[model samples]
Target: MASRPSISLWFVMAADLATVVWMYTVGSWLDHTSKFTATSTLGGHHILVLVLAALAFATLAVLALITDGFTNTTPRLSLIKNLACILSVVALTGLVALILASLLSRIVFGRLRP
Candidate 1:
């Protein structure tokens, strides 16, 4: 008999999928908006949104690590472990991209001053 994938695996997969969709949406929005103006600054709200996205990615990466540790102990669960690894890499990649985008935005717009 074959064993079923755990609930936590499903939860992590769903959450990672949602987070990827959200990051893509925000990235698209940024690209669209950037084309309109040569010099534009991110407002406090925009910064807040970016920060939240980063946190989401970080949280997902941590969850993936924890899930992988707790659930992928048996040889039968190798597939799940691989999937978790991929999800963690994706999350980390998104986090890096977000950080790069923030740095580029700062360079382009200068520092946000009160």
Candidate 2:
């Protein structure tokens, strides 16, 4: 029987897609809404978001390296492989999220500034 994908993988994929969609929709809405104009700075939010994402990616990488599973293991099957796979998923997800968010923001808002 073919085994199903792991939960962490599903979470990572969902999170990546959700992050882009949420950011684009919310950013576009805030840009279009007049009431939020005085309360928030919609400009540069995408950059800020991507920066945060980069930080998160770095954090995950560091955690994976430091965690017990990765520490001086004697060639365990799941330890190194699992950590590496998880990190790969996160990295790819972050890249795709950033690209999609940027593209959608540009298309929807068109050089908006606060």
State the weakest 10-residue window (summed lDDT) of model 2. Answer: 35-44
Model 2 spans with C-alpha error above 4 angstroms: 1-44, 68-114
lDDT for each residue of candidate 1 in 56-105, tens digit (9 for 90 to 100):
54554554475563443456445546655564444545445556777899
Query: Which regions of candidate 1 fall more than 4 Å away from where they truly are?
Result: 1-21, 24-27, 35-72, 100-114
The collision pairs in model 1 are none
Q: 1-114 in candidate 2: lDDT tens per residue?
A: 223334473355445444445555564454446443312223425334433434444444453454442333334534544554554454345345546777888999998876
Alpha-carbon error at 27 in model 1, in Å?
5.1
TM-score for candidate 2, please give it: 0.29
For candidate 2, what is the total of clashing residue pairs? 0
